[model samples]
Target: MAGAGPVVFAAAGVATLAAALLPRVLSRAPISMPMVFLAAGALTFTVVEPLPDPNPVTHSSIVLRLTELCVIISLMGAGLALNRPVGWRRWSTTWRLLGITMPLSMLAVALLGWTVLGFGAAGAVLLAAALAPTDPVLATEVQVAEPVEDPEDDSDDEARFALTSEAGLNDGLAFPFTYLAIALATTPGDWLPHWLAVDVVWRLAAGLLVGLGAGWLLRKLFFNAPSKTFRLAHHAEGFVALAATFLAYGVAELAHGYGFVAVFVCACTIRAGERTSGYHRVLHQYVEQVERLLTVLIIFLLGGAVATGLFAGVQWREVVVALLVLLVVRPFAGLIGLARGRTGPRERVVVSFFGVRGVGSVFYVAYALEAGHFLEAGAVWRVVGLAVVGSIVLHGITATPVMRFLDRKREVLTSP
Candidate 1:
């Protein structure tokens, strides 16, 4: 046991180094950093003896909280990275993707879950709601980087920018649907009025109001304080990103609002506060590093969870549903939503192709289960696992090549 201590310490050191170096090394590769760690986790558990189990069912609260942290941190990064100001016409792609594509995808998934996977109403709803949004965490490579000076060149293209913005905002937007699943689970078959009152009307409204209010207040503190001592931007304190995330999330939840929605909205409002300041870059860098660390931990645990047979009770039908979500449902929904939008063929294809699933899905599933009762919990787990795995593998492999091709095409067209 004394000798084991050094080995463990050495392993930790090596893992940290790998985490730091892997992103740069894999930037040009066909694989992703998440895939590498996920594979490592599965292998480590399979080979190592007496390793601690990390199943989600056994450690639900821990999984929920860790993923919750990952998402909110990523939200802050997403907000800071966007150079584009928030306006109806400027963010038209974001608006269209959020308003049109997201709901269509949800409805399609829910229907498929019901008809194909034999899920009950509550389970189907939970699955659909969970899978509805694009992941803000895993899709970072394809997303826009930190605020660029030139607004015209800020994003890769309209399609990628739109997808990133949509993913960032909709991570919060999907909360109402999760709430609906919870309501269906608790209610005795007549949940329309309550769903309308709480899920649709009250919670959404409260979330928006709280987010706007909290964001406005925080923006003032960060950007313009009464005194220099209280002004966070003056000191360039980046850790406040986490502070804002938790503050917005806690306040909104306390007020019976969707904390997720509040977090993103708060981030957007904060970003809008100091659009051209170098302080925004400082804050974004700090939040991004923190988010990356959190992501590593979560993905490592997810790998551990898989080794412990997280998908043990998944059925063939559920597997089919999962595949359908990644391969059929999301792509088609994206295509339809962006039909009359600004993207060209290559851009549209890339946007539709990379609807990768990650921590958000985990949060939704856990939140739904905690709030509701599903008959086929095992099956739900199975389907979600399959979908996540498929997304990780498929999207991870194609992201680099697809992005490269698109970039090349854009260069050729714009060079003349």
Candidate 2:
């Protein structure tokens, strides 16, 4: 047998090549490229005797950084992909999802965790908060693609596009809930006043303010600077996306705000700065490539993690909870939220169905575990892991076929 190092290297090379080529090969198939890679990782680890364990619990920092990078990169991509201007009316669907569906889902899941799963209040809140946001990293298929040539066609079907954009932004929005979970874990029940003052008011305000400020500063630097050398837009540098991500995130965290929100907000602000500039396209292109590469790495590692017994303690109850989250919780929450909104039935169903959980959930879980102890940490991990895996497989398989069907349906409806 080959050394583990050589085997891992070879496996990665094959995976990368397969990721690049799989979409082309499976263009007509219902299977997703992610489903294939995840399966590959699980099978490889299962069959290979020399592979080392990649458990996230023992390797928290690495997992944290990896998912963190994956998310911010996806944020950049999501921001650059959006052609719609940021406004309440323009983004009505986004607002509805953020305001209504998100809270409902959080409340429902928290209650389930508390009453049904018998988790502590903190653990229940943490689990609900962690799972509240749709993952920005893994829902790429249903999201807006790189700068659409047609301005009119830019927004994905009302449901898909709105859900995609909502996911993009709300991944950060859920940070406050995670903080609430932490507070509940650390403080007494009467800590609600402080939590309201600090966690609810200060953190949310700071994240938005800091993100807008950083984005404004960056926009000026990138596009309005006096010095030619200082004009980042002129240089078409892509790595600055990472700098922006870290800067916004670091600044927000330093000020005790939700860094995730700040990062996404900053991206959106920067994007709003020069919506029509070719420079926007340049930045987006670079970010999308980086996001793709990072996603490949995270998913592959996730596969390795699964093979290393991430799901060892998974019980039938955990499986049931995971299924309910995907099938029952999110879909119902989304549908109810969008009931009177702009989306049609097909669009509503698509949006509700494709609430794919990915890196954001991983980050939230890891962050929560690090910040607060949970007796059922193993059980939480098992349930969340199963949910993520189920999403990757189920959503991945359905995304393409469903989108194609919707497209055809739209064409037929519009035909003379």
Candidate 3:
């Protein structure tokens, strides 16, 4: 007990180093950095007898905040990584994923949770809402890597952009459904009107307004300020990415809106302006670093949670539910969503298959469990834990190879 603090600090130092180094080494390999740290966390916790249990149910509050932070920061990074300006036709893939794939996935997952997994109505909806978004954190392999400094060089690949933009928007868009679950749980009989008025309409509007407003203001300060001292772009400090992230998130929350949406919209808004500036790259890189560090902690704890029997009381059917979500529901839903879209068949398949789940899943589950009274909280946690860990292992292994194959095939098709 006396020496645990130093051990934690030392372990953190090692994790930080791994965070910095592992991405490059694992980039082309089938393995991912999240996979390595996740397994490491499980192994370390399982072998060591003195470590504190990292159960989500046991420490819901800490898990809630940590996962929340990871999601918001990662949202900023994902948003900043986009190169294309937003337009209906340009972002048709994103709209398809968010408007169609996400809701369809949620509906299917909810049905599975209720019928196959034996969850109640509220529990089923919570499960669906928890898993509504493809996690921006763990799906980095399938996402855009960084902002392009050159304006003319568009790094916009359909599959990658769809996944990244979908993850960015859906994490926030999924909130209203999450609140729907909470409303159903707490105020079942008369919840519809209140849900529509507050959760769906007002909150969504507030987030969009706050995000746009904050993004524009920050853009002015960062790029077009009259005074040199006010221009943050000149400094290139990089930490301002965090400042922008927090500012957008905080303002949106203060407006009683979805902070996740605000953070992402703010990043995209800032990015839309001055597309050629090197500042976007600096901001993206800094956000990526911070996101990676936070991810190490969350995924590590997740692996520890697994080793400590996060699925101890889980049923075989619940495991089946988790598997179905990844293998069947998401893939089919994504395919159906992308039907008639601009993506080629192969790109559609790639986008549909890599709906990776990670920190965002953890955050929603924790948030709902903490806010609403659920009898199946433990069971739900086990199923969600299964889903998230399953995703990390499954997607982590397939991401590099599949993306490389797609890249190779694209080059072949376009060659003269």
Candidate 4:
């Protein structure tokens, strides 16, 4: 334990370098950056006894804030990279997933948690709500890679767009359910009306409205400022993305709104500012770097938590429920939602299956546990951890090869 600080600092430097370069290196590989870092963190934390524990329950505050930051930054990145304009018809896939798949998925998971795992009402609902969002942080492989400036190049294809947009939009949608879980846990009776009014209505509306106003103003300042010097986009200050992200989120939170919704909406509004501007790309790149760094650290700590027996309390029923979540509930729900929709059969399968879960799940659980008393806190953590790990490993191995195959099929179909 003597002088462990220097070694930790050195390891931090190496992790930072890997974070920058891993995406390109692993683009075509079956393994993903998350897999590598996750395994590395587990191995390192297990072997190095001097390092601090990474347990979520022991350090709930750190986990909550860190995961929240990662999710919101990722939302901003996803929104900015999307080339598709906002429209009801254009975003039908996202809407379908949000409207149909998410609720169904939540209902199914909550039922399983209650009946199979004996999680009780509040715990079951909390677990379901926590796992509802397809994590924007761990879904980089299936999301938009960069801002699409050219109309001819539709890098944000149907499958990618569906996943990306759903991931961007659903995190905010999941918050109301999380609040429902909190209300159920804390209140003995008469919470429904207030929950419907405040958590469901006011928070959601405030987030969207705040995001719209902030995005509009920021877009003006960035791209349409009267003076050349006032136009930050002309300078290509990548840090402005962070400024906008934090500003939108903070303002929304201050207004008693959902910050996750505000950040993503703000990003979308900024993207709609000047479709052809190269500044969108600059901002997206910076946001991606920041998101990547935060994701790496959080995933690494998660791996450490795994090594430290986060799953020691996991039972057979919990295992079964977690498996069903990834293999059955999400896929079936997504498929049903995507039925007779925009994508073809193959795209539908990919979109349906890639319900990747990561830090956002952890954030929700931490937030809920902090806000309300859950008797099954340990069980919730165990099951969520199991599901998240399963998602990382399963999706990590398949994302590259499957997406490559999808791309090849699209190429064949489009070839003249």
Candidate 5:
């Protein structure tokens, strides 16, 4: 206990080891890896007197960078894991979730923040945008797995396909609104024109163009480079995934586009290039491992923050709104959006209820607070923190059982 530094390192090593094992250990049970890490963080921070308070308000930059790294890595993993082709009909459920469910959820949350929580328009929209994306990090159980022999049938499981694709794209798509919140907060009156042109039109276009372009080039290098030594895919190194993530994001940000969008798009484009290659599996496994480690650290810190009074000023309204956002708003909006879509009733219900919000929400709030003015920054943190905690606990408990039940039901119904 004399040197707190060594204790922290030892804790991290043990936590990483648990991260490697928990998914297999808790595969059938109601418990999840996130739940374990959260509880560990809470308990650790509560008992450890030397540990610094994990406060986001005082440490905005650290939170922003940490969450940003976690999210982009997750987006890359989500993109690479999907086996489905990119087509309107093939991804109908995903499109519905992004285009319809996302907006509806955002509007609903924004309205609640305004009327119930008394946030200004900008603050309301910021809160909504922060919590909008179904996190790619914590929802891995519901997403598609690594590449398989048949690319076309990669995601034959409809629920996995829907959740996977939805998580991949919505993180990037949510950026426009987050920027809109920033615009409204900083400039007030004269922000609309620039926002519409740059945030809406230009950023979207650039992110897509850059992501697709970079992915295509990377795929070429990986699979078809002139020299055998130059073809990285032949080497089968997993670190290329990190290289690809950083490249796509750095290029997109330099071009004034959304790096979140570009990273996912780049990953998907990479997948599209080599659908059946075993190299993708190697890359995906590595990325998944890294993501799991980061998830453990972030969620543990989140629990620590909560234990250290992150929710101290949270009111009844904030608590109720957080509950409504997770329970009522997302479910109803997802149901409405997926209505009459290809999913069966059971699948629809699963997809609707599993809109898991996590680290991405934290990242957005930190990003927004850093960029613009929000007087009620503490309140925003408390609200978003509570919402994230509720989501991790509720969805974490339900994901395994519900997904297993659906899988069983599908097998029975499809038996000849």
Candidate 6:
């Protein structure tokens, strides 16, 4: 297929079509669209010759942009899907996951990297930060569905809600530590003060403010603009999700802030603006389609990368660490975070165990590699690739059965 552009286009078109249909086709089964595409990619590259190498390092810029866009789009869909109002008591589970569980997971993974995988401080920290946040894109099966017609139908079951909300916000929240990893890698010494002043404080605050401001402005334009012609929501153009995503992200990044945080926050702010409007469904549907397309492309490339030796030189220690991050680190941290909080034992376990890692981890690694010197870059890629692949397979296989079981249990428990 060398120089056969139409063949390439046809293949991609087929993949996109499959992406649109596979979720429903595979629903309630112990399988996922990502699994299919990942396997397809591996198999295709394994059998096909003269295919372009999908090494992320060789295509860092493309990798960064692909993963970044996937994340931003997913964050928008996540924000639109959530029905819950932000509140201290109402979002207690979310607060617990963000405040307690995320840090704990990061520390544990970092420790494993340092102690077991023999990574240096910077490498360990980067891996910890990258893998800490549950991916919003790949976790969609466990997240809330589209915006309902009724306002009271807002929140999902606690398990879904907690996972959804945690995945939405944590991607941005993990940026601080990712920057710290960069700081340690790049600087000679004494970057803490700079990190505190800029990375920790200013970037986060700016992202929040910019997100709120952009979202509020968009709300006015969409819902309450004086001119009916300018009231975008009334028109019900779904592509506005892209406009909003780009606007919020661009504005925040221009101010030296975390665009990922701003994008997710802006989505939440938009959800709050018209909580009951059907317009949200329009916006969400559009964003979800785009997000799915991006996901297919990404996971396909990831699979191709693996088939072409992305995981070469991967050692037993690194594989063990990857398993630990999935099995021990996240589950334990999640349980500890949700301790004495809302969810029951089963819900807690489901929420904790379904922290599926995917595109976001790749984003963080690429971003870090761009920002600083990571001596063990190959090791980082291997471990991260294994961890992500493991997550897609392990979580993808079980998410359906686990969720189905929980849904039934919830019904039995909640029946009047």
lDDT against the true structure, each candidate: 0.82, 0.83, 0.91, 0.93, 0.90, 0.92
Error of 3 at 223 (Å): 0.6
- Residues forming the 10-long window of minimal summed lDDT in candidate 4: 148-157
Which lDDT tens digits does candidate 6 get at residues 1-416?
Answer: 56768778989989988997899999978999999999999998998887999999888889999999999999999998888888999899999999999999999999988999888999999999999999999998888987776767744899999988899899999999999999989894999999999998999999999999999999889999999899999899999999999999999999999998899899989999867788999999999999999999999999999999898888999899899999999999999999999999999999999988989999999999998999878888888899899999999999999999999999898899
lDDT of 6: 0.92
lDDT of 3 by residue, 132-198 (tens): 8899999999999889878887767899999999999999998998898888889889999988998
Q: For all the candidates, what are their Cα RMSDs to the real structure?
A: 1.9, 2.2, 1.1, 1.2, 1.2, 1.1
The model with the greater lDDT, 4 or 6, is 4
TM-scores, all models, native as reference:
0.95, 0.93, 0.98, 0.98, 0.98, 0.98
Candidate 5 runs further than 4 Å off: none
lDDT comparison, 4 vs 5, better candidate: 4
For candidate 4, report its TM-score.
Answer: 0.98
lDDT of 5 by residue, 314-411 (tens): 79999999999999999999999999999999999899999999999999999999999887688899999998999999998998899889888988
What is the Cα-based lDDT of residue 67 in candidate 3? 89
Q: Say which candidate scores most in lDDT.
A: 4
Q: Positional deviation of 283 in candidate 4, in angstroms? A: 0.2
- Native-referenced Cα lDDT, model 5: 0.90
| Root-mean-square deviation of candidate 3 | 1.1
Stretches off by above 4 angstroms in model 3 are: none
Number of colliding residue pairs in model 2: 0
Worst 10 residues of 1 by lDDT: 147-156
Residue 282's C-alpha lDDT in candidate 2?
78
Clashes of each: 0, 0, 0, 0, 0, 0
- The TM-score obtained by model 3 is 0.98
Model 2: what TM-score?
A: 0.93
- Cα error, residue 326 of model 6, in Å, equals 0.4
